[model samples]
Target: MSDSSRVAVYLDFDNMVISRYDNLHGNNSWRNDNARDHRPGSGDATDVRLAEAMLDVGAIIDYASSFGTVALNRAYADWSVPANAAYRTQLVDRAVDLVQLFATSGTKNGADIRLSIDAINDLVDHADLTHVVIVGGDSDYIALAQRCRRMGRFVVGIGVTGSTSRALVAACDEFSDYGDLPGVRAVVPTTKVAVKKAAAADAPVETAAAEAGPAKKTAPAKKAARKATAAATKAPTAAEAATALLLRAIRVGMEKSDDEWLHSSSVKSQMQRMDSTFKEKSLGFSSFKAFVESQGDLLELQSKDNGQLMLRLR
Candidate 1:
């Protein structure tokens, strides 16, 4: 968060997209789906889960945040295609500037070229920039990373573990595997009854009752018995774990800050830091905001004047 450690991030979107797509189709990936497939005549639904599973924009940004204040964030891709277009809103939501590159000849090397040029330009223009974080495993970026390091800027590379090029990882001062990054844990789907029961058990009795005041008054004893029965029926589900993680993070953020409310982003980052594999998508939630809103009974969400969401733990 300091000015002295300003960081700039450049993403080769296509490289990441394809890498994740292949990773999903690889062996032993039972949770893998065909969300990132853009084959001809394929009708892929516009689900946030699919896009997120392909390239977790939130995890990437959160990882970048740990290095320093992210002064510049940009992703290069040809957005005209559905593959890249599907992630536009997500990237924007994370405040990442998109640089669209059109495929002119054989392959769209334009994005790579553009990203390198922009990175150099940013380094030259911004004196405070101390780090250049490149998010892609392509060997083509080796030169870019080396150049940044030669110019006295710390270069960090992020890539999918299996798909990343060895040379690309070696070129940077530090390389982070995307899957190993915080907040990217794979979410395994489980029975809804199990999840519901876990949530009931985990829910603070006073808070849940207070939130359910009207229902409580009608049948307090019966409701309490029902909750007990439900908890006894099943153990904590993945959703419950995810919810608890978020609530714990919100509480931590609130305790640390002077303000009572915690930024949704901060809570998410904290949760991931606590467990790198934690991801809302893993809990069957399309997005973080959706997952938070699903727990409306246990938390209060308010939109701040700055257009950011703040969460108040019940």
Candidate 2:
């Protein structure tokens, strides 16, 4: 089935890739490190590395969006250098259009301008375009989000946290902190802790000695694999599945309705309010939405409205 939502994604290669390295790794060079922050001659290499990194980012999103039924995917960059050759290859592989531009003798590079112009033009031209996703770090695009909203289009900005312009974050309908995106956070080997316990609990005492001895090395590995295999096969239970679906619906409602902070009482009241018959105990849940909230991922308890629980982000 085709998704009803239509979104156009724009990648600003020069601005965002630089953001990954600069914000996370910092300018690797002495010049960038010691130079006055963002000052000329400052060893800041974000500008140098940004273009290459953003190209990869564009390619990834180009692929992800397709699965989500995104209607448009475009990457912006100046393509004179051989360094950007890898970028071009991935862009093509991911079916992204490479919007190329140039720098003139008196003027600066116009990649950002090109990106902005094309985004706005398409927003007006394509009535089906409900959401515009931007891949970039420079705060310059902040105004674009506000402007697009005025024209009645939802704008979603993507960038590493702390690198995106505060203006951009505040202006957009929703900002996907690229840093927190799935598979982006520093992997803490969450399985490691879980594995040791599983091995200790499941292995027979005699086998435990054998396994924890010379064979012990492989025990963690086997336990980890088993855990993963089990997780892959186990579908959410009826109660859990319903909770997960409702949580997503709530998030979608907040996004579409321009309500960033949904009231806790309203959220609790609405689940039951939707159907007076919608009860927690009947669904094998303990306390209505509370039971639902306990089982999901990517959602968190934000606060309370009086005494009720409020959820913010997952």
Number of the top candidate by TM-score? Answer: 1
Candidate 1 stretches greater than 4 Å from native: 1-3, 27-52, 187-314
Cα TM-score of candidate 2: 0.49
Q: Clashing pairs in model 2?
A: 17-54, 18-50, 31-42, 31-43, 32-43, 32-44, 211-216, 298-314, 299-314
Sum up the clashes in candidate 2: 9
Among the numbered candidates, top lDDT falls to 1
- Model-by-model lDDT, in order? 0.70, 0.57
lDDT per residue for candidate 1 within 161-263, as digits (tens), equals 6778899888999898887765465633222234355456646675776676643222332344344334323456777768756765665455346888888
Quick one: how many clashes does candidate 1 have? Answer: 2
Model 2, span 176-265: residue lDDT tens: 766554323242233335546756765667565765666443444454544533443356676664564455435433533465666655
Model 1 steric clash pairs: 185-277, 187-282
Off by over 4 Å in 2: 28-68, 105-108, 185-314
